[model samples]
Target: MAKVDILNTKGQNVETLELNDNIFSLEPHKDLMYRYLDMQLTNSRAGTASTKTRSEVRGGGRKPWAQKHTGRARAGSIRSPLFRKGGVIFGPKPRDFNKKLNKKMKRLALKSALSLRLSEGNMIILDDISFDTPKTKSMKEVLSALDLTSKKVLMLLPYKEEKYENVKLSAKNISKIKVIIADNPNQGKTNVDGLNLFDLINNEKIILTKDMVKKIEEVLV
Candidate 1:
């Protein structure tokens, strides 16, 4: 187990939290993390790039000129790849770029990423954070108090319900902060499936409530 300080919104340490060794203290798997990142980036691609081939181009029904008769080189369809404004050769076409990693591998990768952050001392366990209404100023004050106003922060809430809507809305306008849920209560079990590896690794800091930590440990352990 690893002990970490749980800080309040005012940047004061309210308590210490014991982290699960399985999730936060293990040695990071660099290769697995890389693979997960690659898979994520690959799956996110639109893959909608397309180009017209010679056969698909318009106005290419007949030969442009007789072959070998005129002073110009042998002529073919106007849409020939060699001609100006002609179709492309071996051009790109729409296709899937999705990459899949097994559930076990994904879970391991997430653990690795989390462990990496913890080892880097960039993970912050918040005692609690919320808002009565959606207000960016309130969120900014909290971040300032934590001395993370300019840092790229990833905040994980335990659930994404009406109760947390204000918190989510408050953090949305912050350009460097990203908010995500750690678990979905409707799933009826401990499911930390909402954790995103990209956000975890890309952000410079992480902030999560104690409940969110429990939810992550319940599933990851």
Candidate 2:
């Protein structure tokens, strides 16, 4: 198990938390991380690059000249691929780039990413964070209090609800700060699969609220 200091919004340490070995102390797998990242990036591609084919191009209905005569070996549509301003041949078209990884592999990859972040000492735990109103200044104050003003921070929040609006709106305009909802009691069962590997690996630090700690453990453990 890995023990870490739990801090308050003021950046003061209030308690200690012992993390589950299965979730935070597991060995990091570089290859699995690479595969997961590659899959995620590849799957996000739009693949909407398209081109007009010979049959689809305009001015192709009428033949340029006679089929066989008039000093011409053969004649076809002006939009033929061999002619100038001709339609493309075998060009790219719209498609879906999504790729799938099995359940077990995805779980292992997430664990590997989490373990790597924890080992790098980039993970933090907060007792709780809230705001009465949706104010960006309040959120900035909280980040400043935690000495994360300029750091890329990923705050794992509780599940979606009206109450979280304050914090969500507060952090919206702040650069280098992203808020993601974690599994919560409202959601009876764990939703570990919803965790995004790209966000986890992209951020420089991970900050989990007290509620999120148990929720993640429930799912990941």
Candidate 3:
């Protein structure tokens, strides 16, 4: 088991947690990480870009001219490529940007990301980042005290408003800092605080609780 020092919201050391070394201490798989991240990003695409094709364009139902008259090339419809106001021959269209992954793949991918975080020393088990008010400066102070200032942070909380709301908001003003609520549903939803590993995988602190540690161990084991 790997031991991690737990810190409270005050940036003081609280307790230490014993994490499963198998899960948190494994070597990160680069290929699996790439696949997982690719799937996540692909699923988030809207794929709604569409343009009117010649067949789809209106007013093209009628023939502009005879096939061999007027000394002009055979003319079909007003939407022909030779016409000025014609529909696009080749154009983008709406599509589904989702990638299909098995339940196991998702679980494995999440575990992989978590493993990478641990291997890179980016995971932090904090008691929580509770704040009674939305004091941005105080939050900054707390982050600095934790030596996380200037770091793109991804603080996770067990539940919202119990703690870390102000800490989450305070990160809004910081250029490279971010705080995320952990355990939110992963049902292909996006959070402005970054819902995917791609957005927060860099230098953020992925906060974990004792319960979260247990859950991760249970899954990875």
Top candidate when judged by lDDT against the true structure:
1
TM-score of each: 0.93, 0.89, 0.81
lDDT of 3 by residue, 41-135 (tens): 89889999998888877674777777774898787788876678778877889999888767666656666777788877887787655676666
Arrange candidates by lDDT, highest first: which order?
1, 2, 3
The top-ranked prediction according to TM-score is 1
Model 1 agreement with the true structure over 1-221: per-residue lDDT tens digits: 79999999899999999999999988999899999999999999999999998888877578888887589988668998898878999899999998999989999999999898999999999888888889999999999999998899999999766556688889888899988866566556553447889999889999989989998998888
Residue 84 displacement in candidate 3 (angstroms): 2.4
State which candidate, 2 or 3, has the greater lDDT: 2
| TM-score of model 1 vs. true structure | 0.93
- At residue 155, candidate 1 shows an lDDT of 91
Give each model's clash number: 0, 0, 1
The TM-score of predicted model 3 comes to 0.81
When sorted by TM-score, best at the front, the candidate numbers are 1, 2, 3
Name the better of 1 and 2 by TM-score. 1
